[model samples]
Target: MPILLLGNKDIDLISGKRNITIRRLWKQPLYRGDRLFCYWNILSKEREKIFEAEVTKVKILPFKEIISNSELPHKLGYKNSKELEKDLKKSYPNNTKDNDEFQIFEFKKLHVTQWEGSAINQKNMIIKKADILFDMGEYEQSSLCYQAALEYDPDDANLLNRIGDNLSRLGQFGDAIKNYKKAIKLQPDNEYLYNNIALVYLNKGEPDNALKMSNEAFKINPKNTTILYWRGIIYEMLNDFEEALKYFDEVLELDDTDPDVWNERGTLLNMLGKSEEALISYDKSLELCLDDTKDSNTWASKGNTLLGLQRYDEAIECYDNALKIDDSNPIILNNKGVAYMELDDFQSAIECFTKVLVMYPNNPDAQVLQEVCLENL
Candidate 1:
């Protein structure tokens, strides 16, 4: 899917023995199960097609995790991973920041081709290109590639569905729905397409239709936790909290370790003014959230319930946890400032509100809170 360039030395070495390529900050797309055209040039931008390779495996890693590992880089002709990282830093200048991720692709070289012109080869390349772009998070470009592929063979339901997914991500809901409906006509049993249609309806502010479609998908497979989760979300958005709770309860019953469902359950319980019960749900979410940084809203929700219960110190602690994950969130800052105000710590409150104001200059609540803190001082 990705066309990559290898220097003559590296290309020769890989063709002889090596099979893995360490990747960093690669903007052009590639994925496992993708066929790649690899070009090698001894000098300058002029390239010669040396090999066609099929990606066999892909492993993604953070710099911190792989930096200490010397084994993998050594195989690729590096003295060690540190030397490799240094070289990678020059190649991927944008990845110098903390927590940057890189990938390693293991491929086997297929026969080299100087020119590719067969209709089957062209179609495969187009679909492979689309999948690579999709994996790179370039949805619009991926959609374009998929669209181009469709031009070559227009009746592909999978391509239509993929195009719909990209359009939905771009918030082109109407066009997405049209494509989805086409896919559904071809494959009606695809519950996920119905789920996508439901999501599009939700984004269009037609919650009733969203609910209907979700229910339809759920009826197709009552045990599908994802469909039930969407049904819960739609009910929650419609302010039917109790109805939302039923679906959330069913989802958790189906899978107790699901952190997202637990978090949603906590939010719903909190909305229902059942603060103590909500705390247990939040605690469950925190326990299940192996990657807590990805669950900042759960921490913030826990803080909100704590604040409502007037547990100012505990609320501040929870808010601090949330801030650690997303320090610049104005809503969390505002809420933390309110917790400080509740404890009559006006100066601390002022600082938090000031931060919120800096992030959201026109925020009325933060502005009023700042004024109130100043007056108290």
Candidate 2:
């Protein structure tokens, strides 16, 4: 029987009761609380359907020992403890995957053997309080709870990282950086710490420093794809297109299906005036687009490409698609008016310019375009 703790590290596993004796299992490996994600294909007797449950709990008792109890069945979702651990590790990437999908989650290991029942009880109470604060978005208060937990064990790197993360969320970037630095010093090999620190630098607009930190992390573990992706973005911002292209190429080689990367590559190609190549990139981006974010950007990119090619009518249609996605966008509105003027649709041009003027009353270009459209009318 293997039971994953849903939340909070303070509760006992074998028995739901607080202040129970935890043996050696709890002693050797420090347990950080985990939000349970069980992979199961179980049939519900009443529903007669194979259903899945992503059981979330504010706190969990040790359920791994459920098999030992006569009332529980011997069957388990995972084959063994090692397999379960491996799955847990795979759930969060060590960097290869990009975007928010690969974000690191807070997890702790609790050993059933070494826990002092009395201490566990008190810890459970503390964790419950912290959970409430965290739910309320009181990250500072939640961090304080984790900090207080550290008084008993100063060497807990996981808790330290969580505290830093919370601080970062609260916009205390400098303080978060300090905590992350400390965590990196303590656990020099932790990729998450390095990445977190790099993020702080990026948020602070120190892209050079962020790139440097990300490079160090990449060097430590070349397989961290997230760092590679971010490094490419840094190079892009710095206008080092060749280097940025290299990194983007690497990401594409790994996951070519990411429309955002294709869109970005197209932008770089456009910057270099490789209109034909940029069009191809934009096409790829559109092919992989599954949502408005990807689709909208594709429309905008196509509009720019057409405008560059002097295809005014085509450009107007592209801009219309983009405006459909984000109607109030000033840039798209202005661009649409420019396309209308180029196509000699003076009436439509005036309407487009008037819309822009309504949204941005001080827009000098809109006023000028409006004047031109009215003069031509």
Candidate 3:
């Protein structure tokens, strides 16, 4: 069974047969212990009991998991665990998995527990809310909230670091760099802050600066995946493809299901003319991508590879997919039109050229192609 929010205040944990209100759950930060108890009435309407649980054991409900389970049989059992494992593997074909590993797709039911010292305090409330906002993509507001929180607790390393992260997400890379540096100054031994600073520099195309910060971060915490990712980005920007791949490969070993990493590795492989490896990377990315709609770059890359292999029809299909995502993309449209012309589809080529011409009226190549297509017609 799947959990769903009922009304505005209560959540129905259908699988657990429990209905609990948000107010009943113990908020943390001011709480003394990591356990919570929730008092709830079971679906049988005959028994009322409070359940105790650990905070770290709590899980948040996932929308995708809920939607996936909607049409399944109501009976619950562990019989389909093997199938679930297979699905996870398919979701990340390039990743390794243990034979007995199990993954819970969603969170545990919300409950109130006994023995917590105090409810969530004011400072904790603000921090939690700011984190929620950041997760929801409200970076500007989250950063402002985090800044206010840091004012009262300037020595708090985590708060300072998060403020830097929010600023970076808001595209204030310069400010983010400053905040990360401040965090490092306050906590000299913190490798995470160094990694964050390196990331901002990489985002701003300061590869040399990124390299310096990443190296320092790595020296402090060599096994830190975040620092490794920054180092990989810096190396990639510096055209040290081999070094970049090494870092990315390590990241994959740590967490192979990262679609972004696979896509990035594939792109570098393509640049290095490792067509087969690039294809594998692209396939892994496509498998992980939840959206059926193709991205402009995805289609363009696939089309370019197919063209290299002289698979004209397949290349045209990939370009068409790209055009569907971004109709105004002149480069893809032009290249697609060229593919059509190679297949002797003059009129179709003309249509693609015309679309590009609409976006760039003075595009000489489009004009020339249109003229040639008209002549052929």
Which one is best on lDDT? 1
Residue-level lDDT of model 3, residues 1-377, one tens digit each, is 11122220121232233322111121222122244443333233422222333433323333235224533212222135355434445544543233222222222433333334333333464576567668878777677667656655788888888989988988899888888888788888888888888888878878898889888888898887778776887899999999998998899899887777777788788778887798788778777766545456776787877777678899898888777778788888888888888888999999999988888999988899889889988
Candidate with better lDDT, 2 vs 3: 3
Best by TM-score: 1
lDDT of each: 0.82, 0.65, 0.66
Models sorted by lDDT, best on top: 1, 3, 2
Q: Model 1: per-residue lDDT, tens digit, 212-324?
A: 88877887898898998999999999999999999999998888988888999999998999999999999999988987565788999999999999999999999999999
For model 1, the stretches where C-alpha displacement exceeds 4 angstroms are: 1-121, 151-153, 291-293
Candidate 2 per-residue lDDT, tens place, 46-77, comes to: 11111112222222223333222342221223
Give the RMSD in angstroms, all C-alphas superposed, for model 1.
14.1
What are the candidates' C-alpha RMSDs?
A: 14.1, 16.5, 17.3
What lDDT would candidate 1 get against the real structure?
A: 0.82
